[model samples]
Target: MAEHKTNAMRLLDKAGIRYRVWNYDPGDGNIHGTAVAAKIGKPPETVFKTLVAHQGASLFVYVIPVGSELDLKQAAKAAGAKKIEMLPVKDLLKHTGYIRGGCSPVGMKKLYPTYIDDSAMKLETILVSAGKIGLQVELEPASLAAQVSAKYAPLAKRGAGEAASN
Candidate 1:
């Protein structure tokens, strides 16, 4: 196994959350979906990816399943914010200490507003990045959210109902 260390791994340690690390080749330059599809052999829609967005001066983290996108307006409505926007790549990296594709909802540089898609509750467990590309962790969504003090909301920009109706 390829040994790796990342802030996400550290957070799990801090919380005493049980997790199993899965590593794969970092090549192919695939996004989170591709990695999940290849590694777990699951459809991309079943894999969730972490995202960073902003509500005024504060930055928030949103973790939603892959194949779905974060709807700024929907997220703002869910979070009781008048406005929300995708955080700048630079600012996101600085605040979370994680680069894109490697960002985890846990172990961020600073704790800001956090929201996890309610859809996650449907799954027994899900995979999230291990604070680095090519590495992922398997854990329960509810447990993961509790460890990070995250809240649940309708964070997806789309739904199976055809309308992101939230």
Candidate 2:
């Protein structure tokens, strides 16, 4: 079968950005970021997940490595918001034009303030959802940052008892 083209991919193409697409079987259940990384033969550190948080009347986008969790305090600082909370899963599609597990920072319904974890700067390429659950796009971190106007900050933290995998 031919590879699927997502809105995110089309946007990247239109902008003259180069990327490689990877697809995996979603199987009989939901797939998390870590599993995605393994399926694509990439280290967990190189695969990032897009999360939307609501701060006051605004929504912000955060991209962090799948192996780490987003630090809400750090996210608030980066977003310059007094407080922020993850937007409800049910509202993701309405707010971001993508469903849960498939949200990509690019090609959202609107371009919210986007932030990428500073750790990504250390990697040559990173993988993000290609606007779908079974797909991902690999591209230079700097290129992705520039395309989305993302600010780099320390936005992730190792979960309790979770050894750093990246």
Using lDDT, give the best candidate's number: 2
Q: For all the candidates, what are their Cα RMSDs to the real structure?
A: 2.3, 2.5
lDDT of candidate 2 over 1-166, digit per residue (tens): 2266899999999999999998888785488999999988999989999999997669999999998889999999999998999999998999999998889999998889999998899999999999988989999999999889999988998667754443
Candidate 1 residue spans exceeding 4 A from truth: 28-32, 159-166
lDDT, candidate 1, 1-166, per-residue tens: 3365677887788888888787766676456565565776766655789988887687778888777888888788777888988898878777888888788887888887788888787778887888887888888888888887888888887746765434
Q: Give the lowest summed-lDDT range of ten residues in model 2.
A: 157-166
lDDT of 2 at 35: 94
**Model 2: lDDT of residue 137:** 93
- Every model's TM-score: 0.88, 0.93
TM-score, cand. 2: 0.93
Error of 1 at 11 (Å): 1.9
- The lDDT for every candidate, in the order shown, is 0.78, 0.90
